[model samples]
Target: MQKAYKRLMAATIVSFSFGLNHQVSAQSDTYQVVSTSYQKPITTFETYIGNKKIETVRYAFGNAQYINDGVMYGSETDRVVDLKNSKQTVKRLAPAPGQIRKYKDAYYVMSLEDMDHSSLTKYTLDFKKVGKTKKFTGYGRHLILIDNKAYVLADHMKGYNYSIKLHTFDTKSFATLHHETITSMLFAYHMRQVGSQLKIYGIRPEHEEKLTVLSYDVKKQRNVKTMTTNQYVKGGVEKTQTLTKETELIFNQDRMYEINHKTKQVRVLYDSKDDLVDYAYDAKTKTYHVLEEITKTAEFRVKTLNSHFKPIAEYRLKKSDSVSPFRVL
Candidate 1:
């Protein structure tokens, strides 16, 4: 009995010593900061994972922003910083990173280049490699991801003229869905989800009169090429509402119109004239918010509209030179 008790005590001491040694080595690895004259200026930023410091990273530039959950993502040179596990995981992404966006359960980093071709790499939340989509010709700086699809707009050389190329892909499986060439519009600037549809607004090829909006129904899998004519086109919507859905409300510089897509009927919703400073739409509230600048009295006014394009209420704000009193929802 005495010999058995001594063996048990000796085994416990060995296990405790091994654990202590492992903890000391991990601490030394995590807390070590390398300093050198060749290194750039280091900035210390705090990242918290449930009230605990997961990791610290030294970078030349880039501010970390929350992507989703408690994970924070930022870019520095050719690497991506994942702040977690009480240590910073620096993963090599690309040489020239363009933009980083989170979609579904993965993160995509676009790589920009001087040549006509570019690449996009996909990674897991912990910076694990998923896959890459490459060989995109003249891929621009804009990317739009809706649902499980990613739309990439690129400028391709079409004989003597340049045409905008739209490429659609399934984000989950990374498969090509559609590729269409738009000859009417020069480039697209903004894209959004409008009433279960994807809409792209951009400047026209002429670049003269006004911006144009192209409505695409990706759900139907109709990736047809839409060519614009002077009168009316099936897929194009003018700056004004030539045709719209019953629930679709259109807003331009100072006027708002409700449009009928099939009948090509446009009805006036609201007209604020030149007083319209900015406008926004809230998907949750299903309302249109507008800000109007009263130039004569140097005052600002705000108003909200319901789904029927009727004004609910208006409020005037006090004037202050230090701050512009216009707010867009």
Candidate 2:
């Protein structure tokens, strides 16, 4: 290919055996600021899914917990501040640093210091007080979340060496999810259900640089590399790469890929530090709110993206500004 000059936007050709790498729509939608705050060793935000904080709740963890607690990708202490205005009083577990998420007349908490010294956890309200929550010893480095039924993402962990295994169960009388292993380190994860699907997105990459904005698809138990193309010459020469008709580093190493259940097209989105990746949508208000990384800060700028993935309402949330990325209802 000659004259390959794709500056930034994600443009692709056809669907590959792996999957389609989508770009943020160029048109601006709508995104209204539900709320904003800044208070942590790292810059992170949270927003409710509803109008009032009581009706909805948003909680984000600090960066320091990533390494110490191993919550997400950082070891920051498990410090959760209820940015909600609801009557639900979040009771702290103890000096261990944990909060019981409460919202919409429901409640739950990420208890257990360590479940087999493995497993990954999120920060969502734990509703069902299910059956015996067994802390499977030697689990994996993945967070486990059970919806109405008993479906767990058996999080495997080995000092940050993570591997994932999926499991399911029938909703019976009671369930108890727990961790069996406990070290001097702190651990806390959240979970819940939203809409028709269970959406899971993590900003932490395998050591940051390892899993850059890239998509790795598994088809038929094979590590299928879709969206990747190969070149063949009359001389029987062949070369393979994840480039379109034109080759460019359009996709970052830390990109997040989501397959549209409707379009069946694999769309890529990311919450990272690369200049090419950004996201903003008003599932709450502004119809659509966009975020761009500042040149010299950890804050994501606020903006509105059009239907074509273009910016509309623009506002910069400096490193000092703590704005939640997206709301989970």
Task: Please give the RMSD to the true structure for each candidate, in Å.
Answer: 21.1, 14.1
What lDDT does the true structure give each of the candidates? 0.55, 0.32
Alpha carbon deviation, residue 230, candidate 2 (Å):
11
Best by lDDT: 1
List model 1 lDDT by residue over 1-329, tens digit each. Answer: 99999999999999999788645533322111111112333334422222234554454433332232333333335666554545655566665655667777877766666446656777887767786565477655546678877777666664576677777877766677888776667765545555555566555656452445567676774433332223222222323322334435555555665554444354567776446655666555566666677768867666666667677555555454433422243
lDDT of 2 by residue, 106-182 (tens): 33233335644422232234223433433333433333223443334345566766554433323343243322222
| Deviation from native of the Cα of residue 56 in model 2, angstroms | 17
Candidate 1 lDDT for residue 213: 56
Error of 2 at 262 (Å): 8.4
Off by over 4 Å in 1: 1-102, 107-135, 139-142, 146-148, 155-160, 170-178, 184-247, 275-287, 293-300, 306-312, 316-327
Model 2 compared with the native: what TM-score?
0.41
